[model samples]
Target: MKLRRDGESVYVRPMKLDDAEALYEMRTRNQDFFQTYEPIRQKLVMTLEDYRDRISDDIQHWRDQTGFTFGVFLQETNEFVGRVSLSNIVYGAWKNCTIGYFMDQAHNGKGYTTEAVSLAVDFALTDGQLHRVQAAVMPWNQASVRVVEKVGFRFEGLSKWYLQINGNWEDHNIYAITQEDWNK
Candidate 1:
């Protein structure tokens, strides 16, 4: 589903193919920064076509009820500065999802991500759609740990080899926020 999200200083919405150019520009500009945590996709340096193809798949995932992703844009310029998502959805009594996100390096530390995450979490729990949303942050990623914490995800202890990051086993601290926690 296409979601509309807004906060005091920013706007966020479901991503679209037309966003390829702006998204690519931001990724290219922050190549070195993102490379630290994410495996560098060679196609990122090629053309907007690659971005379009990937985002197209994500958009379809939304339609197919497989996942949800949103692009965070600056209100003043409508520039795509980041993305936040909830994937790995599970139905039944669980009704949970996994959350992940990142902001453009230049936009870091401006509280954009914190606010964006709050909005996304609110949307997730507002209608009782998800019972819980979880995140796994690498210990070294202090910034991400802070973001998830700011959005009410509490530390849930360490998970050895928690994620496959940069194509390797990586340790992480699992964090989670449930509808009950969010309400409180």
Candidate 2:
């Protein structure tokens, strides 16, 4: 699956096999910063080969229609700066998925994540033929909260101890946008 979506300053597409190195580098560089917001990983990348295998899984997931992972790139340099994903997809009676993303610390406060998410939500509700997309952000992550809000996701509620972040279970503010919400 070839998914390419562009924003004013950034573009998003799947990470290719050849991009494994870049992916590893970005993850390694941002591991410490990302840890504050993400679940603590035992290791960022055990080895480049293992990282490549994970990249392959991402591709396969996109192909299989189970999940979609996209690398955020700078339009000017085409530099890999971040990643976004629409995963936990569901169909039939309830067509929905959850959105996830992270940006390189260097690129923070640039609106890159907001634009990337907007484009991703477009794909989720339009191209992906899904009805709803949701995001769970830690209460402390105001940056991410703003990103989803900028993309028009409304606050749904709070999920107590929703996910374990950096080892301890953390409360999250749930936000969501349905197809109807997106159309508005």
Candidate 3:
């Protein structure tokens, strides 16, 4: 619900409209990092007005209980280095949500993403009172695969056409950790 800061390296906080410029900047700079795995949206090429509209929409989604998106900040430089989120939350018998994230290319190998993801997962499983948190990683993304594994998610095999990544159905290996599983 609030943006949280962890020393001079990592910070996790709810996304804000004030974050639009930095977010857009990050996306623009890391175009290649996202182009292959994300939806093909020219939205990143938007002007300030377009960014405002999109940020408004992002805020509304979280307000409406659709999803929770957090900006990952590099506290030393106070830059938005990436984003981490819990989306597609389901209630009732399936109290779960999916974990997703990305880091700035310059910050890729420093273990910041993994550290941020670990914090997010802990928040989801503990503070958020969620039953399970899951992630679907492309098998080729060894770094991402390792991040989830390190955070306690167990490999659950591959799912064909699991997600519509990059505008086409893509196979993704499923990884998940239930609250009980985490406790174990």
Q: By lDDT, who's the top model here?
A: 2
TM-scores of all candidate predictions against the true structure: 0.92, 0.96, 0.89
Candidate 1 residue 148 Cα shift, in angstroms, is 0.9
**Which regions in candidate 2 have their CA more than 4 angstroms from the true location?**
none
The local distance difference test score of model 2 is 0.89
**What value of lDDT does candidate 1 attain over all alpha carbons?**
0.85
In model 1, the runs with Cα more than 4 Å from the true position are 40-46
What would the per-residue lDDT of candidate 1 be over residues 1-184, giving only the tens digit for each residue? Answer: 3278789877778899999898889888888888778754655565778889979998998877678888999888988899988899887889898988889999999999998888788777764288899898899999999999888898999999976777787999999999899988
Note the Cα lDDT for every prediction shown: 0.85, 0.89, 0.82
Per-residue CA lDDT of candidate 2, range 57-168, in tens?
9899888888988889999999999889999999888888999999999999999999999988888888888999989999888899999999999999999999999899
Report model 1's TM-score to 2 decimal places: 0.92
What TM-score number comes out for model 2? 0.96
